[model samples]
Target: MTTELQFFMSESKKKIEAKLPELIDSLLAPESLKKSMIYSLEAGGKRIRPVLLLSVLKGFNQPVEKGLEMACAIEMIHTYSLIHDDLPAMDDDDVRRGKPTNHKVFGEAQAILAGDALLTYSYQLVSTISEEPSKVVSLMTELSRAAGAEGMVGGQVSDMEGENKDLSVEELEQIHHHKTGDLMVVSLVAGAILAGASERDQANLRHFGRELGLLFQIKDDILDIEGDAETIGKPVGSDAGNNKGTYPSILGMDGAKQRLEHHLALALSSLKEVDMDQSLLIELTKYVAYRNH
Candidate 1:
């Protein structure tokens, strides 16, 4: 990774980690719920979504502080998803971020409520962004669509249904487009929208986000096949164990690696189409492609 990109990522992570706790502390909720929510939020991950959002804002020369609330909102929504995804009814995983799953630590009911609280609290954070009401409304709408039934939830349902089935590549892509790609696209596009970017620029970033999201998932599938449990913070080969359709499963390892390069090129090309200081974004894209964990 470039030194500049490493510095940018570290600065972004510091900002987000500081803001997350402050947001949670402001909530008027039960102590247990608060504890449960904070537990998962504090559990370590790359914080990629929020970092991407902030990086986009910086790319457009916007003040990063202006987008911090939205970035925190994104992280909250992401953490909530992880919490729910680890439940017995879903992937039935017992570990996340190298720790016991949320349900295991907090009990299933509290864990469910914790996810619910985070999801709702994300909107509260969004509502606080000091932008024009129209822009805020637009952001709220984008977030709702991305994280709602037509996006992540819908994709998740499709994923569950496709387990143990020999899903065609197109079908698998359809499932991932909504499940994993939507929020990622919104993360970049939301920053563009907030920066008062031109419609064309916003569209280009959205395209970049879509390609990057696909690339991110493809790398995840690859990691599942070849990543170490210690570095990845979860068991390798979980996808194969569950018989879930993944890039490596459908396209052989070589084919999946080739697809990764394809999406990486597409993502970079899309970023180039937009007229902005995309140095950070470009480096971040490379980091995503090569991230080990």
Candidate 2:
């Protein structure tokens, strides 16, 4: 990644990290529940989802802080997903972001509650946005659709059912489009909405986000085979051990790499349609496409 992008991401993370604790602390939840929620939030990540949301605002030459509340909301949703995804019934991961999983540290029940709390609070935060009622409604509507059964939840169900079964590339793509891509697309669209961009501009961002999300998943699949356990914060080859259908498993390593490159090009192409200073967004795409973790 470029030094400038690295600096931008680091600053972005600092902003989100500072705001997350404030959000959780302002709630009137039980102490244990608050601890569990904050514990997972403090676990290290690149803050990509939230950063992506803010980056879209930056791309429009708007103040990044204008979207900080919404960015934190996005991060909460992403973090909640991780907490649940690491449960014994799901991916069963022992570690995340190089620390013990929330379930491992807080026990299964509290971890589940923490995830539920975060998910619920995220919507509350967005719903309270001081924008016009229409924009607030638009944000809430898009967020629900992206995070609910029609999006990530449905894709996760499909993922669980597809385990150990041979799935076509189209099937895998379908799973990820809703699973990972939709949330990302909505992040960009949310920014466009906040920035008062044209509908066409938002559509362009949606197309870019789809390809970018695919690129991210394909790279993740490839990394599951070749990434360092310490760097990626998990055991290598876990997907293969679990018999999950991954891009490398289906397409072979070289083919998966080729596909990653293909989407990178397409993402850049689609991003060109956004009417803004897109250098930051372009760098952001490369950041996702080429991340080590």
Candidate 3:
């Protein structure tokens, strides 16, 4: 990571960590479950989704504090997804964010429960916003759909089913569009809408998010193929080892690189149409495309 990227990432993480306790406090249920919930919530991650949400708020000249709750809520949902995704039933990864996966630390049962709690708690937190009921309802709807069967879950199913098969480009896109792109696209849409952007502007934001999400997964595929374990902070070549469909598997390395570059350009171009300040958001897009971890 570049110094600037590291700086912003660290900054965003601090903010999210500070907000986490309160969010979890609101969801306090059985005391035993709290441990797993807090454990996974506090585990270190890039806070990319929250950062993107806040960036959209800043872009539209909205008070960042106003969106902080929604930002935290989205991060909670994202973390829940990661916890479940890392379970043995899914990707079966042993590590995440450079630490033991949640299931490894908390045991499979608790980890599964933790994901369920966080997913439910996210909607609760979002619904408690008190102001802008319509916006909150709309964002909640988007989030629920994105996290459910039609979005990430669907993408994951496709991924698992096609792991050992040769997947076409269209099929790969479908997998990514649901699994990775859906949350990202909807997150941007929610953020833009909450920030008072017009429908046309929000649609453009969705396009930017869709392209960025695809590019994000492509970079992940590249890392799986060629990234260093220490540098990428996880097991390298997991996709290939698992026989997962990836851009590199279908397209040559050079071709994948070209496609990533093309999407990056398109993302930047899409931002030009939004009638808002673009400094931080522009920087964020660049950071996403070039991120090494």
Give TM-scores for every candidate, taking all chains together and pairing residue i with residue i.
0.97, 0.97, 0.94
Report the C-alpha lDDT of model 1 over 221-268, residue by residue, as the tens digit. 999889998888777897788889899889999999999999999999
| Model 2 residue 248 distance off true place after TM-score fit, in angstroms | 1.1
RMSD of each candidate? Answer: 1.0, 1.2, 1.8
Q: What's the lDDT for all of these models?
A: 0.90, 0.89, 0.83
Could you give candidate 3's per-residue lDDT for residues 1-293 as a string of tens digits? 55664675677678888998767765538876887888888886777788888778878988777777788888888889899999998778887777788999989999999999888888888898867788888888888888789998888888888888999978998899888898888778877978889988898888888888988988888887788888887778766777777898899788888889998999989988888887777788887777776
Candidate 1 vs candidate 3: which has greater TM-score?
1
- lDDT computed for candidate 3: 0.83
Note the residue pairs that clash in candidate 3: none
Which structure among the candidates has the greatest lDDT? 1
> Which segments of candidate 2 are over 4 A away from where they belong?
none
Tell me the RMSD of model 3 versus the true structure: 1.8
Q: For model 1, which pairs clash?
A: none
lDDT of 1: 0.90
Better of 2 and 3 by TM-score: 2
Which ranking of candidates, highest lDDT first? 1, 2, 3
